[model samples]
Target: MASKKKKAPPPSPQSLGLPTGGVETHAHLDMEPLDAEVGAVLDRAVAAGVSRVGQVFLGPAAYKDGKAKFADRDDVFFILGIHPHDAESANGVNLDAIAQAFHADPLIKALGEIGLDFFRDWSPFEAQRIAFREQLSLARELDVPVVIHSRDAAEETLRTLDDMGFADRPVLWHCFGGDANLANEIVARGWLVSIPGTVTFPKNEAMRRAVAAMPLGAMVLETDCPFLTPIPYRGKTNEPAYLAFTAAEVAHIRDIEPAEVWHATARNAAGFFGLTLPSHT
Candidate 1:
C-alpha cells in the first residue's frame, strides 16, 4: 500500500484577519543589546504592518550608544522617564537633563513604565514614590499621558496618584493584572487598561474576566514585547508584529470579531499617545 501523505497543521485561528496599521503601545525596544540594531527590527515590524511603536527610553546605561536607540527615526516615538528601579540613580542633574530633553522633544509622547514595583523593590519605597511623583508632575506639566506599572503595590500606587493629583492625565495601567474590582474602578475613573499576553493563559482567569468585562473604549492592546508572547507563541520572545495574537485573544474573550477589537484598541492607542496612525494596507 502506498504511504499516505502527511497533512499540514492548521494555522492558528488566532492569526486570522489581522488588521493593517496596527500599533504596539508598550514595546521596550530600548532594552539593552537588543536596542542596537533595532532599525532592522523596526524594518521587520513595518513590513508586518506595525507602523508605530512607542518606545520607553530609560537610563544612559540602558541607552549607551549615545542618545537612546532609534531616536532619529520618525516611525518610533518615545515616552521618556526614569523607571522606578532607577529612583535613587535619578539625581538632581539627571532629572533636570531629562526634563530639558522632554521640553525639547515633542515626540516624547508620555511619561511611563514608571510606578511602583514592590515585587522587586529595586528602589526604596520613598525614592520610588518621589521619582514617580516627579515624573507625573512632568507629564502633567507637559500635558502628556502617563503609563503606569504596578505590581503587588497597587493600592499604594493608586493612593500616591490620588494624593499627588497625578491621576488627571490620560493614564494607562499597562499590562494590567489587577482584579475585577480594581479594573472596574480604574475604568470608572476613565483610565485606560492595557491587556497583554498574560490574558491568554488558561490560569489567568481574573485577567480574562477583567478584559471581557472592560468597556471597549477603555481598553488598549499591547504586546509588552520581548515578554508576554500570546497563545501559540507563549514563552517565546515577542515582537510588535505579535500584537495581532493579543488583539485576537481579546476579541475572543469579548465575543466580538477581531477587527472590532483592532479598531477600538488602535483608536485608544492613538488617542492616548496622540499618535496619527497610518492607514492599513
Candidate 2:
C-alpha cells in the first residue's frame, strides 16, 4: 500500500515573518455566516500582525450590521457603498441611506467597492453606470475618497470617472486585475491599487507582473476575505489572517523582503484612508 501523503502545517505570523501592525485594507466580515466566530477571526488577524482591518459594505443591510458591530473598535474601519452587481437596487432612497451612514460614522473612511462589473452583469449596465456616477457624485460632495471595483470593465470605469471630472479624486482600485499599462495609468492618476490574495496563485502571472511593476507607494494589500484565499490554503475560507501569505508572495514578486511590502502597504493604506497607523509596539 502506498504511504499516506504528509499534510503541510498551517501558516502562522511567525512563519511568514509578517511585519507588525499591517492593515487588511478590504474585507467583508459581515458577509460571513458565522457571526459568532467573527471576533475570533479578527483576533486571529491581530495575532497574525494585521492590526487593522477595513470592513467593506455592499448594501444597506451590511452597512447597518457592520456599523453596529464594529462601531467602537478603533482597529476596524469601513467603506460603504452599493456594489456594481447590486446597482439595480440602488435607488435614490438607498443612495441617501448610504450617504447618511457615511455622514454619521467618522469611522467610515471611503465610499466604495463601487464601479463596473461587466463580468458578472448581475445588474444592468445602464443601472450600474447610474449608480456608479451617483455614488461618485456623493463621494465628491462628501469630500471623501472612493474605493473602486472594476471587473472586466476597466476602460469603461476609467472613462466614466474621467467624464465625471473625478479623475483626480482619491481612489483605491480594490482587487486590481489590470495589466501593467493600466496600473501605470492608475498610479499616474495618483490612485492606489490593492493587491489581493489572488497574487499567490502560481498561474496568475499577469497579476504577479502587475504587482512587480507597481510602485511601492502605490501599493496596498488586502485579503478580500471569504474569497481569494491564498496558496497553501487555496480552497479554505479566507480571513484577514491569510494576508501575510499574500504579502509574502508580493514581496517575492517585487524582489524585496516581506517586511518592506508590509510596512509600505500599511503606510499607503493609512494615507489613503486618512487614518493614523497605530504603533505596533
Candidate 3:
C-alpha cells in the first residue's frame, strides 16, 4: 500500500518581505480553523504586511455571533450579507433583520458576497434572483457599497445590476477570474474588481492576464480565506496574512513592485469600504 504524504507547511507571509500596507478586502475569519485562533491569525496578518481586513458574515446570526470577536480589532471591518446558497431563506423577516443589523452596526461596511451562484445552484434560480434584488435594494437604501459573488452567472449578474440601477455605483466584483474582456466590461461600468489568490495558479493564465490588463487603481486583493490559498500556500488553510502572495503575484503580472500593488489595492479597498487607510508604523 502507498503511504500517505503530509502536506508542506505554507511559507510565512513575513518571509515574502513585502512592505506593510496591504488590505485584505474579503475574508471569513469567523469560520472554522480560522475562528478558533482568529486572534493569532490577525497578528500574523499584521506581521505579513496586511494592515487591514474585512470579515464577512454570511447572515444576521453570523454577524451577531462573530462581531464581538473583532470588537477590539480596529483593523478588521465587517461585511454582512446573504449568500446565494441561502437565497431561499431570504424572506422579508430575514431581510429586515439584515437591515437592522446594518443600522445597529456602523462598522458593517457593505452588503455582499450576495449575487447569483449558478455554479452551485444550491437554491432555485428564481430564489437567488429575488434575494439578490432585495439585498441590492437594502444596500442602495443603506447607501453602502455592494460586494458581488457571481459564479457562472456573470452575464446575468451584470444584466441584473444594470436593470436595478447599480451602474457607476460603489460595487466590487469579488473573486474575479475572468479575462481582460470581462475585466474591461466591469471597469467600464465603473466597478472595482477584487483579485483573489487564484491568480497565483499557473493554470489561471487568463486571470494573470486580467491582472496585467486592469488598471491598478481599479483592482484590489483578497484572500477569501479558508479558501483560495495562493501558490506555495495552495493546499493549506488560507488566512489574511497570505494576501502578500496574491499581491506579489499581481505585481509580477503587472510588471511593478509588490509594494505598489499592495498600496494601490489598499486604497481601492479603503474607498470601496468607505474607510481611510491608517498610517502604519
Candidate 4:
C-alpha cells in the first residue's frame, strides 16, 4: 500500500506577523457559530494584531439585541442601519429606534452598512431605495459618518449619493469589491473604500488592481466576517483575526511592507469613524 502524504497545517493570521493596531471595519459577530466563540475570537484578534472591530447591526432590532454582546469592549464600536434585504418593512419606527440608539450610545460611530443591493433583491427595489434614502437623511440630520453597501447597483448608488449631497462629506464605501474605475470614482467623491478579504482571492484580479491603484490613505481593511475569508483561510469562518491576512494581501498587491498597509488602513478607519483606538509602540 502507498503511504499517505502528511496533511499541511491550516493557515493562520499569525503567519502574516502584522503589527498591532489593525482595524476590522466590518463584521457580523452577532450571528453564527462566531457568536458562540466571540470571546475567544476577540482574543485571537488582538493576538493576531487587530485591535479594533466595527460590529455592524443589520437594523434596529438586531442592534437592540446584539449591542450588549460588546458592551464591555471599548475596542469594539457599533454601526447600525437597515440593510437592503430588510427594506420591505423599513419604517419610521425602526429609524426612530436607530436614532435613539445612536443618541444614547457614544460607541455608535456611523450609520451604515446602508445603500443599494440589487444583487440580492431580497426586498423590493423601491423599498430598498426608500429605506436607503430615509437612513441617509437621518445620518445627514444627525451629522454622522455614513458607511455604504453597494452591490451590482453602483451606478444608481453613486447617483443617489450625488443627489443627496454626499460629495466631500465623510463617507466610507464598505466591502469594496470593485474595479479600478469604480475605485477612482469613489475617491473622486472624497469617499474612502474598505478593502475586504476578497482582494486576496486568486480570481479577484480586479479588486487587486483596484487596491494597487487606490490612494493608500483612502483605503481601509475589513474582514466582513463570518464571510469573505481571505485566501489560505478562504473557506473558514472569518473573524477580526483574519483582518491581518487582508492587510498583508493589500501590501503584497501594492508592493509595500505589510506594516505600512496595516498602519495606514487602521488610521483611515479610526479617522473615518472618529475612533480613538489604542496605539502600539
Candidate 5:
C-alpha cells in the first residue's frame, strides 16, 4: 500500500482573524510551482479575511499566466511591467506589448516590479535602466503608480525616479529595506513604503524603527510571499494567510492595536492601488 501524505493543518482562528478590510498588497501566486497550490492558498487567505491580492505581471510567461488568473477573479487585481532582473527580456516591441496588455485589462492597475537591481546583473545594468525608465514613462502616460524594486541601487533608483518626474504619481518602494532617513525623505515626498515580514527579523533594528515611526497613511503591509515569511514562520513558504503575523508584529513595534494597523494599512493599500475599500459604515 502507498503511504498516506500528511496534510497541512488548517489555519488557527487567531491566525485566521484578520481585521476588517485587510488587503494583501503584493504576492506572486500562480507564478511558478506556487501556482499548483494557489486555489488552496487563496481559500485559506479568504478564510483569514484577506479581501484583496495584488498579483504581479512580469515577462511574457508571467503576463500570460497573470491574464488567465485575472480572468477568474473579481477580488484580485494586477500590476504589469517587466521585472528588473528580466530586463533583457524586453525589447521595443515587447515594451509595446506590455503597455498594450495593461490597456487591454483594466484589472491591471499599475506598472511595476520595475526599477534598478545592481545586486545581480542577470540583465545588463544599462538594459535595466532603459527598461525602468520606459515603464516609468508608460506609467506616467497611463496615470498609474509604479511598483519599484531597488536592491543595492537605492540612490540610483531614486535618482532615476527623480529624472523621470515620478513625484507626480504614486510610487511604492516595495519591501523597503532603507534606513529611517531614507524613509523620512521618501515619506516626506509623499511616496508610499511597504514593509515586509523581514522587519520582524531579530537584527533589523533600523527597519523596526522605520516601521514604528512611519506615518500610517504612507505605510502598507506585504508578505512578498514565498520569500520574507515573518518570525515564527521565517523558514517556510509565505502565504497571504500569514499576514496576521505581519500585522501583529507591526502593531507590536508601533505599540498600537493590531486591528488599527490592519485598518490603516488596508486603507492605504486600497487608496494606493485604487481599489474600493469595504464600507465601514
Candidate 6:
C-alpha cells in the first residue's frame, strides 16, 4: 500500500512576523462549526496577534446570535446587515430588527456586508437593489460607515451607491477582488478596500495587482474566515489566526515589510470601524 501524504504544518503567527494587535476586519464567527468554538477560536486569534475581530452578522438572525455570543467581549465588534444573497428575505420586520440591534449595541460599528451580487443571483436583482438602497439610507440615518459586498456587479454597485447619494459616507469594500483600475477608483472615491486570503492564491494576480496599486491608507486585512483560507492552509477551515498569512502575502505584493502591512491595515481598520486600538498597538 502506498504511504499517505503528510499534511504540511500550519504557519505560526510569530514565525510569519505579524505585528501585535492586528485587527481582522471581516469574519463570520456566527456561522457554522466555528461558532461552537468561539471562545477557543478567539483565544487562538489573540495568540496569533489578532486582538480584534469584526464579527459580521449577515442578517437579523445572525445579529441576534452574534449578540448573544459576544455581547460582553469588548474585542469583538459587530457589522450587521442583510447580505445580497438574502435580499429576498429582507423586509420591513427584519430590517427593523437589524436597525434596532444596531441602536441597542454600541459594539455594532457599521451597516453591512451589504451590496449587489450578480454572480450568484441567489436573490432577485431587483430585491438586492432595493435592500441595498434601503440599508444605505439606514447607514446615513444612523451616521455609521457601510461595508459593501460587490461581486461581479461592481459597476452596478457603484452606480447604485452614487444614485442613492450615500457614496459620500464611509464605505469599505470587503474582500475586494477587482482589478487595479477599480482599486484606484475606490481609493479615489475615498473608500477603503479590504484584502482577503484570496490575495495569497497563485492565480489571483489581479487581486495582487490591486493590492499593489492601493495605498496602505486605503487598505485593511481580513480572512473572510471559514471561507477564503490562504494557501499552505487552503484545505483547512480558515480562522482569525490565519490572518497573518494574508498579511504576509500583502506585504510581499506591496514590496514592504510584513509588519508595515499589518500595522497599516490595522490602523485603517481601526479608523474605518471606529475601534480604539490597545495602547501597545
Write one digit per residue (lDDT tens) for candidate 1, span 1-281.
99999986534423475656767888887664456668876776666556688877675344334345676677877776788888887777766766777778777788777898888967998998888888777777777788898888888888877887755458999888877888987887678998887887889998888888879899988878778877777766777777777787888998998888878888888988988886552
Give lDDT tens digits, candidate 6, residues 218-274. 999999988999987898889998999998899898889988888888888998998
lDDT score, candidate 1, position 112: 78
Write down the TM-score of every candidate.
0.88, 0.95, 0.95, 0.98, 0.92, 0.95
Model 4: worst 10 consecutive residues (lDDT sum):
272-281
lDDT digits (tens) for residues 1-281 of candidate 2: 99999987776755786757799999988875534577888888888888789999888778886567775567889888999999988888988888888777788899988999989868999999999999999999999999999999998988888887777679999998767888988888889999999998888787788889879999999999889888877898888999999889899998999888898899899988987776652
Q: Is candidate 4 or candidate 6 better by lDDT?
A: 4
Score candidate 3 by TM-score against the native.
0.95
Worst 10 residues of 2 by lDDT: 31-40
- Global CA lDDT computed for model 5: 0.81
lDDT of 5 at 58: 71
TM-score of 5: 0.92
Candidate ordering by lDDT (highest first): 3, 4, 6, 2, 5, 1
Per-residue C-alpha lDDT of model 5 across residues 63-96, encoded as one tens digit per residue: 8755675466677888778999988877878788
After superposition, the stretches of candidate 6 with alpha carbons farther than 4 Å from their true spots are 1-8
All-Cα superposition RMSD per candidate: 3.2, 1.6, 2.7, 1.1, 4.1, 1.7
How far off is residue 212 in model 4, in Å?
Answer: 0.6
Model 1 lDDT, residue 276, Cα: 88
Residue 6 of model 6, lDDT score:
100
Clashes of 4: 0
The C-alpha stretches of model 4 lying farther than 4 A from their native spots are none
Better candidate number, 2 or 4, judged by TM-score: 4
